[model samples]
Target: MPPIIDPTKCTGCGVCVDVCSEDVFFGSKKGKVPVVTYPEFCVHFNCCAYECPEEGAIKVRIPLPLQLLYKGGDR
Candidate 1:
């Protein structure tokens, strides 16, 4: 699934954009917000989610099959 952005909680510090090696997001200079520029490369890595300082700024959903494997601590 795609990475979810919660505008209310997003401080838009661009941390996620900077941390993402895949270039999945872009920072907006006019506003304190980051936009999801490339949704397809997300890969449900959830790195952005964890990197976000806001409690729930980014939420990435992994597919069921992969979720199961991830749940087993493989990922």
Candidate 2:
């Protein structure tokens, strides 16, 4: 799964671009918001979301095939 960035919430801080090891995100040279340029490169580690300073700025949805592999737990 790839990281989905919310333009409204993103501050274009470049943190996500900096933190992504897979080079999935691309930050604009003109200081515009970054984009997920390579979705297939994403490993679904969610480093982008965790690095985002703005809440709800990045949403990483697990792929349906992978989602079925892990069972939910009730705490």
Candidate 3:
């Protein structure tokens, strides 16, 4: 799934844009929210969300298959 940015919480620090290696998002100017230029290009790696300093600013959905694997540890 593509990353979802929470406008209310986002600081527009461009950390997400800078950290996204897949280039799924386009960088914005200083203090501007980054744009999701290629949502489909998102590989669900979550680098952007992980690196974002703003809490709840961004959310990335993990793929179901990967989610299952991740949840497997809960067993």
Candidate 4:
């Protein structure tokens, strides 16, 4: 699965857009959170998630081993 953005926690910082190695964010405004422009480039690297200031706002697919760390266990 691709990354999903939670607007509530999003500070509209636009850091995700700026740090993206690939041009994945297509939003016009500077502060507007970028949209998933190139889903294929995501690669589940969690780059955007790491840059985001708000917790749980930017979520990328977790790696298999780490997935078990999320309580309730990996699905």
* Local distance difference test values of all predictions, in order: 0.74, 0.78, 0.81, 0.74
Instruction: Name model 2 segments beyond 4 Å from true.
Output: 70-75
Model 4 residue 42 distance off true place after TM-score fit, in angstroms: 1.1
What does the lDDT read for residue 4 in candidate 3?
90
In model 3, which regions exceed 4 Å deviation?
Answer: 62-75
Clashes of each: 0, 0, 0, 0
Ten-residue segment with the worst summed lDDT in candidate 3?
Answer: 66-75
Q: Please provide TM-scores, in order, for all candidate models, with all chains considered together.
A: 0.71, 0.78, 0.75, 0.69
- Candidate 3, pairs of clashing residues: none
Least lDDT summed over 10 consecutive residues: which range in candidate 2?
23-32
lDDT of candidate 2 over 12-66, digit per residue (tens):
7888888888878754432568877878778888788887889998889887766
Candidate 3 residue 33 Cα shift, in angstroms, is 1.2
Clashing pairs in 2: none
Please provide, for model 3 over 1-75, each residue's C-alpha lDDT reduced to its tens digit, 9 standing for 90 to 100.
Answer: 568999999998888888888888765565887888888788887788889998889999765665654344553
Angstrom error of the Cα, residue 36, model 1: value is: 0.9
Between candidates 3 and 4, which one is better according to lDDT? Answer: 3
Report how far off residue 71 is in candidate 1 (Å). 15
Give the per-residue lDDT of model 1 (tens digit) for 1-75.
468778888887787887888877754442467777777777777788888888988788765566553345443
